[model samples]
Target chain A: MIKITEKPIDVQKVIDTASSLNAGAVNVFIGTVRSKAHGKNVVWLEYESYESMTVAEIRKIIDEASHRWPLLGWAVSHRIGTLKPGEVSVVVAVSSPHRKESFEACQYIIDEVKTKAQIWKKKYLKTGRNGFQQAHK
Target chain B: MKLKIKTFGITRDILGGRLVEIEISQPTVSLLRSELTRRYPDLENLNSLFVAVNNKYADESEELSSTDEIALIPPVSGG
Candidate 1:
C-alpha cells in the first residue's frame, strides 16, 4: 500500500494492513513534525509533493521492496498540507515471518524516501532568541 | 535542448516557483545541478542536494532529456 494524503496517517490501519497469518514480525516507522530546526524552535511544518507522481513512486518502492525482501506485506503513507509540532507526517509498515526482513524493510522505506521519494517538507521554526527561518529544498 | 526543472520544499521556495527553464545542448544531470547551484548560491550552501530525472533518484552524470521530469531535491529531515 502507498499514498500521499492530506489526512493524518492512521498508524493502526497501516499495521493491520501489513499483518498476515503467517507473519510473525511487524515493524513500523513514523515521522512527525518537530518544533525545532537547526537550533530554532519550530512552530510547524509544511509538506507537499507532486501528487500523482509521488504516489506512483511510493507504490514502486513498495513493489520493489516486497519483491527484494519477499515480505508478506508493506505500506507507506505520507501526509501533506500543514502540520503542527508533534504531528505524524509519515508512516511505514512492513511484516514478514521474521524480524530481520521487517526491520530491514522499515529502514529501507525511510532511507529511500529521504533520497528517492518526491515528498518535501519545510520547517517553520521560531527560535529561543526570537529568530526565524524556513528550512527547505 | 531545453528542459523544465520542477523544484519543491526549500528549493522551490528559494527559486520562488515550482518550475524553471534551462537551455542546454544534450543536457546532463550534472549540468543541471551546477546551474541551479550557480543561480542560487545561498541554496547551494544551505542543504545537501540530490538530482532526479523523471522522478527517480539519478546520478549527476546521468544523461538528461528535455521531456524528463527533473527535480532538485534537498535533504528532508523534517517530520
Candidate 2:
C-alpha cells in the first residue's frame, strides 16, 4: 500500500497491511514533526507534494526495495497539509521472513523517499514566519 | 511553443503561484529551465531542481509538448 493523504496517517493500518502469516518480522519507521528546528520553536509544518507523482515515485521505491531484499510485504504512507509539532507525518512498514532484511529495507525506503520523492515541507516557526528552507534529516 | 509549468513548494512561492506560463522557441527541458530562470531569477537560488514531464523526472534533453505535464521539482525533503 502506497498513499499520499492530507489526513493523519494511521500507523497501525500501515503495519497491518505489511503483516502476513508467512512473515516473522515487521519493521516500522514513523516520522513525526519536530518541536524545534535550527534552534527555534516550530509552530507547525506544512507539507506539500506533487500528489500523483509522489504516489508513483514511492511505489517505484518500494518496487526497487523488493528487488534488493527478500520481502513479504510493505506499505508507505505520507501525510500532507499542515501538521503541528509531535504529529505523525510519515510511516513505512516492511515485513520479511527475517529481521535483517526487514530492518535494512525499511531504512533504505525512508532514505530514498526523503531524497527522491516529489515532496517538500516548510517550517512555520514560533516567530510567525514560515521558513523557506527545506526540511533536513 | 508556449507551455504551462506547474510549481510547488518554494518554487510555487518564488513563482508567486501554482502555475506559470512561458513561451520558448525550443521545447526542451533544458530550454525550459533557461526560460524559467530568466523569468523568475529567484528560482536559481534553489539547492537543486528537476523538471518532471508526465509525472516522471525528465532529462534535460527531453523534448516537451504543450500537452505534457511539466513541473518544477526542488530538492525533496520528505521521509
Candidate 3:
C-alpha cells in the first residue's frame, strides 16, 4: 500500500497492511516532527506535496527495494498539511521471510522517500519566523 | 508560447503565487529556467532546482508544450 494524505498517518494500519502470512518478520519506521530544530523551538510545521508525484515516486522506491530484497509486503504512508510538534508525518513498514531483509528494506524505503518524494516542509518557530530545511543534511 | 508553471514550497514564495505564466521564445526546459531566472533573480540563488514536466523530473533537453504541466521542485524535506 502507498498513501499520501492531509490526515495524520495511521502507523498501525500501515503495519497491518505490510504483514504477510508468509513472512516471519515485519519492521516499521515512524517519522515525527521535533520540538526543536537548529536551536529554535518549533511551534508547528506545514507540509506540502505534489500529491500525485509523491505517490508515484514512493511507489517507485518500493518497487526498487522489493527487487533488491526478498519481500512479502510493504506499505508507505505520508502525511501532509499542518502538523504540530511530535506529530507523525510518515510511516514505512515492510515484511519479509527473514529479519535481515525486513530491516534493510524498511530503512531503504524511508531514506529514499525523504529525498525522492515531491514533498516539502516549513518549520514555524516560536520567534515568529519560519525555516525551510531538508529532512537530512 | 505562453506556459503556466506550477510553483511549490520556496518557489511559490519566490514567485508570489502557485502558478506563473511566461512567454518563451524557445520551448525547452533549460530555456524556461533561463527565462525564469532572468525575470526572478531569487530563483537563480536556490541551491538546487528541478524542472518537472508532466509530474516527472524533466531534463534540460526535454521539449515543452504549452499544455504540459510543469512545476518547480526545490530541495525536498520530507521523510
Tens-digit lDDT string for candidate 2 (A1-137)? 99899988999999999998999999999999989998778877889889899888888899999999999999999999999999999999999999999999999999999988888898876654644444433
Candidates 2 and 3 compared: the better one by DockQ is 2
Q: What is candidate 3's CA lDDT for residue B58?
A: 97
- Off by more than 4 A, model 2: A128-137
Task: Give the CAPRI rating of model 3.
Answer: medium
Each predicted model: what fraction of the native A–B Cα contacts (within 8 Å) does it retain? 0.41, 0.84, 0.82
Best of the two (1, 2) by lDDT: 2
When just chain B is superposed on the true chain B, each candidate scores a TM-score of: 0.87, 0.92, 0.94
- For model 2 the TM-score comes to 0.93
Clashing pairs in 2: none
RMSD of each: 3.4, 2.4, 2.6
CAPRI grade of model 1: acceptable
User: Ranking under TM-score, best-scoring first?
Assistant: 3, 2, 1
lDDT for each residue of candidate 1 in A33-130, tens digit (9 for 90 to 100): 76666877778788888666677767777877887786997778889998998889988889999999899988987787767676778777885576
Fill in the DockQ of model 1.
Answer: 0.35
Error of 3 at A19 (Å): 0.3
lDDT of 3 by residue, A48-117 (tens): 8999899899889988999999999999998989999999999999999999999999999999999889
| Best-first order by lDDT | 3, 2, 1
Q: After superposition, how far is residue B73 of candidate 1 from its true place, in Å?
A: 2.5
What TM-scores does chain A show, candidate by candidate in order?
Answer: 0.91, 0.92, 0.91
